[model samples]
Target: MAPPSTSKLEDDVSVAFRNPSHHSNCAAELDNKHVNDQDDYKPERDARVWLIFLALSVSAFLTPLELTSVSTALPTILNDLHGTDFVWIATAYTLASTAVLPMTGGLAEIFGRRPAMLASLSLFGLGSALCGAAQNVPWLIAARAVQGMGGGSMASLTNIIIADLIPLKDRGLISGVLALLWAVAAALGPVVGGALTARPGQWRWLFYLNVPIVGVAFVLVLILLNVRAPTGTFSEKMRRMDWIGNFLVVASSSACVIAITWGGVTYPWQSPRVLVPLILGLLGLVLFLFYEARFAREPIVPFSLVTNRTSFSGYLQTFICPFLTLGVIYYMPTYFQACKLASPVRSGIDLLGFCITLGPAGVLGGVSVSRLNGYRVQAWVGWTLLIIAMGLLSTINEDSSLAKTVAYPALVGVGGGIVYAVASFPVLAPLPVKESAHALAFFSFCRAFAGVWGVAIGGTILQNELSRRLPPSFAESFPGGVALAYATIPKVASLSEPARDAVRAAFAQSIAVIWRVMIAVAVLGLAVSLMMKAVPMHAQTDENWGLEKSRDGELEGREGTEEGSDEKRIEKESIEAVI
Candidate 1:
C-alpha cells in the first residue's frame, strides 16, 4: 500500500469534485480506498434521515430508563417475588448487558444496522414481557438478563446508527440531543419506578412499560431504516463475523462482571469464589486481545483503534469519567437518605438538581464542540469542574445545609455531562470514517464496563467503612455486612438518639470517602484528556452505508461512466505518445 503520487491524487480529486457522483470512483483510485481528509463527502439530507434519527433517539431513551428505573423498584420486586437474594436482580441485568456489548459491532457489520437494530429491539421487548410475567426470583433474574442483553445492544446500536446518519463535525448536536434524552430518562426512572412500586402488584409495570416504547422504535426501524448492508448469503455473512473473538470477550466480560458484582458483597474480597473468577477473567481478556491482534481477520477491537495516542487517550478519558460519575450518582443518594434522613422519593427529588443540570450542560458542551471545532477545551473544563466538585462534596456532613447538598452534586452533574457528550469525538477523530461502528461499539462497551466498577468501588468502600464505623451492636444485626447499603438506609432513620446520631455520622463519614476518591479519579481523567490531540473531525459519511438506494445506484452508474472515460483517455494518450 504505497502512497498515491501527489499529481495523480490531485488529478483524481479534481475530477471527482467536479461531479459528486464520481466521488466513489475517485476514492477507489486512492491507496486506502476511502476518503480520509476530504470535507465535502456529505450525505444528502433527506426526510428519511430525520425519521431514522427520531427512531434512534427513542431507542436511546428506552435503554437508560430501563437500567435506572429498576433500582427504585427492587425492594418491591423482592417482596413480591419472595427473594432474599435481591443482589442477583441487578447483577444479572448488568452482567448480561456488559457481556454482550463487545459483540455488537461485529454483529452490526455482518448482519447490517437495520437487522441488528431490529434484533436488539425484539430481544428487548421479549425480555421485558418475560420480566413482567415472572413468577419467582429465578424467573425475574433470568428475564432481567435477557432484557439487559437487548438494552446494552440497543445503546451501542443507537450510537452506531447516529455515526452512519451524521458526520463527525455535525454529530455534536445529535450527540447532545441523545445525551439529553439519556439524562432525562435517567432522572425520570427512579421517580417512575417508585411511583409504580408504591401500588400493590404494580412493580411489574416497570418492565412492562418498555414494551410499547420498544414496539414504536421497532416499527420505525423496520420501515424507515433501510441502510445499505453487505450483500451475501447467510453462511457467508456468518463466516465474516469474528465468532471466536466475540466468544472470548463475552465470556471474559461475564466472568469479570460476576466477580465484581459479588466481591465484598455476597462474599469476602479475599474469598476463592471471588478471587478465582477475577484472576481468570483478567487472563481471558488478555488472551482475547492477543487473538484479535494476531489471528482474527475481523477483530471485535482493532489494534488500530487503541494504538493511536489520541484515540487511546479518548478511551481512557471515556472510562474514567463514567467510572467516577456513576460512583458519585450511586452514592449521593446514600448521603441524603442516611445522613439527611430523606425518604427514597425525597432523595430522588433532592437529586433533581444534579439530574436536570446534566442534560442541558451536555447539550451546551455538544453545541460548543460543534461550533468551536475542538473538544479539548470542554474536556479540560469538565474535568476541572469534576475535581472541584468532588472536593467540595467531601466536605458534606450530617449538618450540611440543603443548598450545599444540592449544589455540589449539581456541579458534578455539569462536569460529567460535558465530558460524556464530547468524549466520542476524540475516539472517532483519529480513525477512518468506516471504523465508526467498531469504534463506537467499543465506546459503548467502555461506558457500560465503567458503570460496574463505579458501583462496585462505591459499594465496597461504603460497606468496609460502615462495618468499621457503625456501632458493634448496630452492625451485628446484619452479619453478611451492610454491602447492600440502600437496604440499611430505612433502618437508620428508625433508631434511638445516640444510635441514630452515631449511624448518621458513620454514614456521612463513610460516604465522604467515595467523593474523596472521585477527586483523584477526576484528576486522572484530566490528565488523560490532555493526551488527546486536536485531530480534525471528518465531515463525510461512509459512502457504502447510506440509506438512499436510488440515489446511490444513480451515482454508481455515473461513476462507472466517468471511470470508463478516464481509462479511454489514458489509453488514447499512451497511443498518441507512442506515435
Candidate 2:
C-alpha cells in the first residue's frame, strides 16, 4: 500500500518522536525520504482505533460524571464522614483540573498523545482508587486532586486525538459522538450516585464504580493502540516539556480558582483569605505570560495561537459559553430538588431534558459539518437557542411548571450541542498537522478554565443573593424577632405556616434573580458568537516538510497509481472484511 500523504506522515512522525515507547521501526526506515513511496504505503481501517475510542471515551464519562454525580452523593459522604467542609471535596478536583489543564495540551505535544493519555488515565484511576479507600474527608479531597490531574489530561486529549486522525470535515461527526457519550454520563450521574448512596455502601460506590471502567480502558489502550512516537530522540523531546511554564500556569490558575471558590462562601470577598490568593494568582498569571513570552523553549501554550485574532476569539467564546450553559446545569438541579421539592431521582430525570438532547444535536451538527465544510451557521443558531433558553428560564419561579423547566434545559442543550460541534474548527483549522494536538490541548484548557469560573461566579451570585434576600424577608416576617429567633427559624421545619411561606418565597425570589443574571451571561455569549470570523474548512498542511498536494486534489506522487498499488490496499481490504 502507498504511504500516507507526506503532510499526514509528518504528524504521525511528530507523535512518534514525542514518545519513544510508541515508536515504530518503519518510521526510522522512512526518516530521510522526501516522499513516501506510493507502493510502500497502505491504508486499512483498524478495529483497534475503535477500541482506543472506547477507552478514551471512558475518561470523558468519568470527568463530567464526577462533576454532576458528586452532588447527589455529597450529603451521604458528609454524613458518613461527619464533615462540614463539604465544598472542598468538589472544589479540590475542579481546582486541580483547572490548574493543570493549560499545560496538558503542551505536554501532549512534547510527550506524544498515547503516552500522555496513558499517564493521565493512570493518574485518574489511581485517584479513583484512593477516593474509594478514603477514611476521611482530607483523604477524599487529596484523592480528588490526583484524579483532577488525570481528568485534566482526559478532557484535553480527547480533542487532541480527534484532531490527529479525523480530517476537518469529519471532525463534527466524531465530536457529536463524543458529545453523546458525555451527555450520557452527565444525565446518568445523579441517578447513579443517588442509587449508590441509597444502598448500604454510602458514597464509596461513586468512586468505586470508576475503577472497573477506567481499569478496562487503561488495559485496552495499552494492548490495542499503536501510536507513532516523535521522530527525534526521546531525551531531546523530553527537554522540551516546559516544566516552569506548566508550574506557573498551575499556580496561577489554582490560586485564582481557590479565591473564587472560597470568597463569600468561606470568607468575605474583601478578606485576606480571598484577596491574597486572588492577587497571588493574578501575579502568577502575569509571571507565566512573561515566562512564556521570554524564557520558555516550548511554552505550555504558544503565544502565537493565543494572539491570533480568530483563535483568540474562539477561545474566548469557549470560556464564556460554558460559564452560562454549565452554570445553569450546576444550579438547575438544586432549584428542582430544593425549591421545587423534587426527589433526588426525580430531579436527575428532570435534568435529562438538557443532557439528553445534547448528544444527537452535537452529532447532527458534526455530521453536517463534514458535508457543509463550515460550522458558522450552526454556531450562530446554537447561540440564539441558548439565549432564548436562558431568557425563558429567567422567568422561572416557585410556581413555574415542571414542563417549562424541562423545555428551557432542552433548548440550552440544543445550543450546547451546536457550540461544542463547531468550537474546535477555529482552533485546529489554521495550525499545521504537527501542531493539532497542541492546539486541541489549548482548546481543552480554555473550556476547563471557563467551567471553573462559571461555577464560581454563578455560585457566588446565588449565595450572596440568597443571604441578602432571605434575611430581610425573615426580618420582615417576624417584626419582633430576636437573635435566637433568627438562628432558630432557618433550622426549624415546624415553623408557623406563614413563616414557612415567607422563607420559601424568599428562596424563589433569590433564585429568579440568579437565573436572570445567567440570562445576561448567555446573551453575552450570543454576542461573542456573532463576532467570530467564519473561515472556510481546509485540509491539514505540513509546513515543516513543505509537502504540497497537486491540482487534481491528490498528494504529490499519487498521480498515476491505482489504489491497489498502495500497501494500504491490503489493510483496507482487511478492514472491509471486518466491517
Score every model by TM-score. 0.90, 0.81
TM-score of 1: 0.90
Best by TM-score: 1
Q: Looking at candidate 1, what is the lDDT of residue 263?
A: 80
Model 1 steric clash total: 0
State which candidate has the highest lDDT.
1
In model 1, the runs with Cα more than 4 Å from the true position are: 1-40, 79-87, 481-484, 551-579
Query: Candidate 1, residues 41-83: lDDT per residue as tens digits?
Result: 5788788899999999889999778766676566567767756
Report how far residue 396 has shifted in candidate 1, in Å: 1.5
Candidate 2 local distance difference test against the native: 0.70
Clashing pairs in 1: none
Badly placed stretches (over 4 Å) of model 2 are: 1-45, 199-201, 231-238, 471-496, 541-579
Worst 10 residues of 1 by lDDT: 30-39
